[model samples]
Target: MSEDAPTRADGDRDLFDPNYRAAVVDLLGALAYSELRAFAQLAKDSELAPTLGHTSALAILAAHELRNFKLLTDRLRALEVDSEEAMQPFVEAVDAFHARTTSSNWLEGLVKAYVGEGIAQDFYREIANYVDPDTKSLVLAVLEDQGQADFAVAAVRQAIEEDGRVAGRLALWGRRLVGEAITQAQRVGVERDALGSLLVGAPGSGGADLAELGRMFVRLTDAHTKRMERLGLSA
Candidate 1:
């Protein structure tokens, strides 16, 4: 296959299965809405920037998120799914996550942009492992860092350096963010059975078993700890 084309999984016919297709649709839908919301959140958070440089950087990240949203929607259209319809089911859950985790200050917003989004991307990437190669590629592509990680880490670490107490507060904030994130994931699993089947190895679903599901969470937790440390905060 050419580099521009989505490579099909060799002899993996699960893509044609109804259950598998539904799972992919749910995955893409959740991701598409997430990118859309990330774009909105980033733009809104830009107003909290203390400097013009920070504002411009956040605007750039927001633009990247919009582009990623387009990519996901385009893929949904390719699957003959209405992008809006696919995203609708996830709107309430995703919006609730943002609402509950609203940041009170510039630093908290930055940490949410970093730690909160980081765990989400990690979770999606883990789910990608059980999906078709084409869908997996798109998931990973849309989840790309877009310079947010380095930017947030540098800005947050600098703040912590200026005030050692900043680390303590942000550490607490990071912990809460992770907790909320896990809760959101659990909620999605409960509400989206098609999507959940992808994690539990449903018949013909091409997913992991319970043991592997447990390992996936371990991996996600480990990655989140590393991200918190990068922000100079305790996990």
Candidate 2:
């Protein structure tokens, strides 16, 4: 998000421009708050776990998210941006996403966690490609899989093996998660011009075009499908 960085390969140079630097800070703040929120939700969901082992596993995942939050906030501080101010703009939309997609049970929570994280990682990674190398590294690092996938997949698949009927319901829940995510994403796009500019580029900057954004969503959806399949759920 630093304005001192060189232009990117596309010559967009959003990273080095003051206006775009604010956008980058906005993006980082959103990501930072996201990790923190996920941490809280994961901790709350752990209470629904049927076993002590499941509880401990979820707690570990929550810790990983907390660590990611710290990383993001540290970067924001270094950039001299107030992390909370940067995150403020996107808070309502993000909260609405979780509010609408709240899980009804432990299995549903697990599926939501797995699927949601997968899609989000795909998205940020796509955006990172346009950013400075250092910023991109931080974004990718924050999105890195922290052992949550294997645990969620194994737990979910084992549950389905035990009670096959659950798959149909969980599959529906998976679809619901995707739907809510898409809806919220559109909302974010409308509400955050800075973030939208990161995707579509500034008016004259020749950033990512519509076709590129389409392709990025395709990649994200494909990744989401694979993650759902791994969980023995339909996407």
Candidate 3:
């Protein structure tokens, strides 16, 4: 990941670069909607919780997603972009991802929240490196991993400790989540040129080459694996 992002010294000139602006808007929009959907899904999944304590924890997690969604939407508005309009292009793809990865049980839902959200955050953080400093800061801020890691690991490990059989099923579930996430991401890459430009360059900027993109994938995959391991689940 490049830390040599254009500083404020580059001034507003780069901000006015149409391609960069479009790409950033597209990125923000996709993130905004993803957060929004995560909140909705988390809220719904909270109902499947076995106890009030678990339900409350899941609701808190949903709130975190909503907060990130608000940050992204606010950024979009500051750029004079309609948040909904910007997110429109990604609606179907994101929706499709969640639809295909729906969980059949409470533990599966938790695993999805842990593994799926972790992967999405990793991918966005990777792309942030290629963007300007301001955008990179916002992306990083919105992606703060929070305390979900500890919660996921404790809950999952406890479940596995109680019933060793669950480990095998959840390991497969984690793999399915990774696969579906990759499928949707590739679909979006092919369908959204603006988002794709983040990897290959918008127009003027020398964006990541094929090798760089490959490395980015490796980073995301490695991060996902670690996240799954943290949850006591297989990647």
Candidate that would win on TM-score: 1
Model 1: which residue pairs collide?
A: none
Alpha-carbon RMSD, candidate 2:
2.9
Clashing pairs in 3: none
Q: What is the C-alpha lDDT profile of model 1 across 42-82, one tens digit per residue?
A: 99999999999999999999999999999998888777789
Using lDDT as the measure, name the better of candidate 1 and candidate 2.
1
Can you give the TM-score per candidate against the true fold? 0.93, 0.92, 0.92
> Given candidate 1, what's the lDDT at residue 29?
95
Please identify model 2 stretches exceeding 4 Å from their true place: 1-16, 203-206
> CA shift at 192, candidate 3, in angstroms?
1.5
Better of 1 and 3 by lDDT: 1
lDDT to native, each model: 0.86, 0.82, 0.83
Please identify model 1 stretches exceeding 4 Å from their true place: 1-13
lDDT of 3 at 153: 81
